[model samples]
Target chain A: MALIEVEKHEVEEEQKPEPVRVRGLPFFPHFLLREVVVMCLIAGGLIMLASIYPAGLLKPADPFDTPSPIYPEWYFLYVFGFLKFWTWDLGPIPAKMIGVTVPMVLWYGLLILVPFIDRNPSSDIRKRKVAVTLGVIVLIGILYFTYFSIVHH
Target chain B: MTLNDKIYKWLDDRFKLSELLPPIVKHPAPLNVVSNPLYCLGGTAFLCFLILVITGIFLAMYYKPTPAEAYKSVEHIMTAVPMGSLIRSVHHWAANTMIAAVMLHMMRIYFMGAYKKPRELNWVVGISLLLITTTFGFSGYLLPWDQLAFWATKIGTGIAGSIPVIGGYISLILVGGNDIGAETLTRFFAIHVMILPIAIATLLGLHFMMVRIQGISGRL
Candidate 1:
């Protein structure tokens, strides 16, 4: 997200910009074709090897054979794990108040006004200490709580 | 302007690109978010969307998007289609990647203070887009109709059921009954395919406009 500004910042390979001598010969940038090709080949080769001598292994999924440890993907694990840790076991009203409805309402409501909340006009990492701090805290909280769920549970 | 014609001409004369780029950028102020942070994230998300649609269409050629046929179709794709397993894996990996990418994109906006000032509404819309994306992922879980699909969705919809006054009704609406069955499958399918897509597209349009109006915020 604009780590280096394109408009003003000269993100040359080196620390300083090398002068562009206007040589008319069209020199295209070197494409990383070799690495890309090798990766594709490796993936394809592995898949092909598996195809040649198939184990033919597949168990018919039974309706009743519900597997344990039914976790969401690594992503939703944050939310899934959150749900497990913070079940608002306060019946219908409180559950609704804390869980589904409030979370949505608060998140959306807060988001709608974040611009006002952190009224700093700078996206500069140096200037916007408050925003950056908040960002780090949120990121840490998500990862930390998610870790707790996996480790403790 | 037609991109093919513009691009072919531009490649013929890129030295003049700066002039051409701005003249182009200056057009359609709000919603035309070119040359910005929003544009960068939007472009990446677009790329991910392209990956998903193309891979999903390929997957759908063999995918049975129902309970009984879902697992078999996935198996057939893995075993029967040429390089099907790799394709499926790529699709799986790509979906997870897209979610992460979008989340990071949102975080980038959040931290950068791009969500402030004239872009507040857009930020809210962006959050809604985040929710929709996760919803898309959640509904998609059930497409396989495997054990993962069954209980995960059950739990997900159960969360919906936890809402106070209308919790039970919401769960009923989501699951289509006391249990997850055909109705639930069809409902989730409609969301994954139809409703969520439309909502995302609409929000994306608005987000792009707001970004264009606001331009890119700076790091300093």
Candidate 2:
């Protein structure tokens, strides 16, 4: 009976919340100070880069003379890769729907559904193995496809 | 009284600046957030956006929306205007940086599990913001009216044109006609400079308001 009481007490102690630690300096000076310094550094770096390598202005566009293998900006390369990779003998409508519409919808849908789907309240990454694994896999896939588009194009 | 104190009192009496400023100026950030560098990505993105706006305004002063003059205007800016190339390059780099920063910020939020429970709406808003930002890039890409800009936009709109039933309409709306031409350039210019800025600013305000109300998410 005594041992049971002792065990119950220990469990209650474990369940108690830890005291919150307020460790940082006040926002007015400390945080702002750091932010200002970082901003100045970024500005300096940008100015230096801009001076060193000014953006090149390409020739005027001619509708009659089309460029071969036109590609979108770097960020859109993954989408470009998707369109290339999914080129089976599927009809135009089916190809567009399946290759373009479906993947885009699914990607955004997954993003929207994340909070609802992962109900586990813990923020510790290790505790949420499935979420972490999926996130890493998606990241990897994006990078791989992006690389492929760049090299192949 | 000191000169500074006298000026402050004068402004405070007229505008009630003293009463309105404290809450914002003295707002407390969580200690962990202060110490962590990852939390700064959103602020950096905001900074980049500010840079883009300033530089974009300067470029717009010289830029022409017409298909015939668009490329020439850009070239003129680079060659004739004072520090024009530098400003344009900075705008280009900043846009790229802002996109990167926003992406990193989103990844950080995801990994930290900051989008749970009451913060879900903020996540949705954030995703919308990302799409808007990308749209900003896409619209702006056509403004130079160069070979790359023309062809890339043609391909981009072509992708939209491939959508089943409404694809044709969507492409028409995007390009403002059958092909990428004067209409397309003008439409993209309008969206880039006017529509997108207003939309992004409004969404940013809402996102920040939510963050301020909810406070930063705690670590596990």
Instruction: Estimate the lDDT of model 1.
Output: 0.65
**DockQ for model 1?**
0.22
Give the best candidate by DockQ. 2
Model 1 over residues A78-105: C-alpha lDDT tens digits?
5555555566666644543464554444
Runs in model 2 lying further than 4 Å from the true structure: A1-21, A89-93
Worst 10 residues of 2 chain A by lDDT: A1-10
Model 1 iRMS? 8.1
The 10-residue segment of model 1 chain B with minimum total lDDT is: B26-35
Q: Pick the candidate with the highest lDDT.
A: 2
TM-score of 1: 0.70
Tens-digit lDDT track of model 2 for A41-85: 887878787888777667799998888777787788888777766
lDDT (0-100) at residue B205 of candidate 1? 89
Q: How far is candidate 1 from the true structure (C-alpha RMSD, Å)?
A: 8.8
Collision pairs in model 2: none
Highest TM-score: which candidate?
2
